[model samples]
Target: MSAAARETPRWLAPAPLWTARTVAAASEEFLRPWIAELRTDSFLADFLSIVGGTDGRSPADLPATLPERSDEDGSYRLFPSHSRRYYLVLASLVCHRPGIPDHTVQPALGERALFVLRRIRQGAEKGFVPSATDTGTWQPATAHALVPGERELPLHRAPVAAFAAPGTAAATLGMAAGQPSARTVRYGYIPVSGGDTVADDVTTTYVIRAVLVRDPCAPVISAPTQPFELAGPLDPDAPRRPSAATTKGPTS
Candidate 1:
């Protein structure tokens, strides 16, 4: 093996054999803490303020112009800092109904947006379900809370999906100041949104990958999960094949 390949840590084991149920469960596990936090009124209030309110007035240039904490770089910094746990808002997208051309919907970020977290907890025990949107092409109004137009919109809930993975700290990238010299890395997820149709294919399989660096000088170790698929309405004009959404590291 190459020197870098040899440096792969034992903890950086191969991804588990993923099934729809297993994916849902893992997604739920990652989100449970945030979900509990959302259940609290005070937490919801603070989170909404961070996300800006859910007024339903989304910016015309969404995904491109999504807001971020001034102190943060690419991902929006989330709260509960006192606990030393962090959730970062990595990417957000406005998905449209099937048959709608890509241009009509808000453009997607080159980075992977949140996927399947919204429905993981409440969806069927056997599989995944994407969140639903009411309009043909709608921009997400807020990252922190579900908006008014989406079907079955709930109050005090996150509009985007989230998952957990191992990642290097922002300081490593010089995005933050005032850090210990030693490198810091943590397992975290970038919040993304998925609804009716993230893509035009009848079924889309997302290949989730994780990369970790144990030390500043260590070679990065990478792994990929078993293919996880989500069903979507088929667009006759679109190719009849499974589409792939590969995960790169977080936006930053």
Candidate 2:
């Protein structure tokens, strides 16, 4: 529950799980500050991999802003859920697509990799209904280092404190992998029916994707799925944080 709701009436029972409002509030609590910082700061040098749409739209095709409220035009976009989507984009640095001539950045990772990337950002909320369909393993470098039953690595420390568990660092990487190398768990979802709702309502383990950055200065869990160019111009029209008065639901 949100810190504000910690005190309840003596007559009411404690909330069994963090409410949707609580989760949304929490996501903002954790993500907004970072967004604000990123807005003014240099994107800190690093390679990046922003997710392009399933149709493979270039990152340039991605709107300058992300969906902050459920009713916004970008609401139907991927990285669904609460306003967290807005902040995630703001905190990221978009790079140029490697081989494409379009001058736009591309999302090279498959869709399932994208889902894991977002859920990790959702932090430690309880209701984790995954939006990706039919999960399977595809090994990547980080997965090799942190898979379940393996010793914890320095990068294994909570990807971010918001979504971390006590043993999340040591937590099993989940079911067996297809290869001994790090396997990527990929899934695709059709937001048509209750699709976006899963991102909002369903609670699953807040698992994040790990990038195998060899650099000592690199962040463990990151926004881009993989390293693109070392540097590129960031999106000038990236989303900004909304005021408290114009509040929306929790993505905490």
Candidate 3:
């Protein structure tokens, strides 16, 4: 069997994972600010120029006057979720494909080693029943770093308060802020699915991926991470590994 064939089918996974709406919402919450900054700093435009896309003209000049919401088409109506996809694609090229014919800039090791966390929900909830084919779509989620010793905190006592602001988190935790080799960091997500329905069995798990973020304000310049099912309680000190599973379900 080929590599693609070796991949697990989505339908075989456990039920009621992270809902699509929740994934979008969570990713947007964490990544939008950085994306907006990327647009403002002209990194996106500069990147486009470096790697010419379907239309082989430099759009490097377009971002200056374009609103934050404008995409490649120069349309003002792009939704946040849709815009993230566009940005992630740009990131994929920058991280994986590296440079084009004449560009000299390259992603640093620190930039290429950032983390993207996708939280998966399990157990039960009340809403429209989903068919086996309802596996969620593949999209990048919020990219962040874990503070030193954060994983040591117990699950219920997770240092969520420290994460109120990325900068504050760094300051309070006494580590180098941003993507630096000196700081040992990781990120996790809290499930938002328990809001509407009450289920005794509801549980949440995080699906994390290794990705490159050229800057805090940039989208992930890498391909989407594959999803995988991790059984049992999360072990904070366990080694990190990549997986390929993104399960979708009803939002509420």
What is the C-alpha lDDT profile of model 1 across 1-252, one tens digit per residue?
Answer: 233433223112111111233223544222221111121325333443333313442111112212222121222222332322222222111112321111111113222112222221122211232345533333232222333333221111132111112232222322222332221112223233322345443433332223222232332212222323332222323322211322222222
RMSD of 3: 20.8
Worst 10 residues of 3 by lDDT: 153-162
TM, every model: 0.21, 0.21, 0.21
Question: Which ranges in model 1 have alpha carbons more than 4 Å from their true place?
Answer: 1-185, 196-199, 213-219, 229-252
lDDT tens readout by residue for model 3, 138-188 = 232233333221111111100111111233322222222232211111221
Supply the global lDDT for candidate 3. Answer: 0.25
For each candidate in turn, give its C-alpha RMSD to the true structure in angstroms.
20.5, 20.5, 20.8
lDDT of 1: 0.25
Candidate 3 ranges with C-alpha deviation above 4 Å: 1-112, 122-199, 203-205, 221-224, 233-252
lDDT of each: 0.25, 0.22, 0.25
- RMSD in angstroms, candidate 1? 20.5
- Candidate ordering by lDDT (highest first): 3, 1, 2
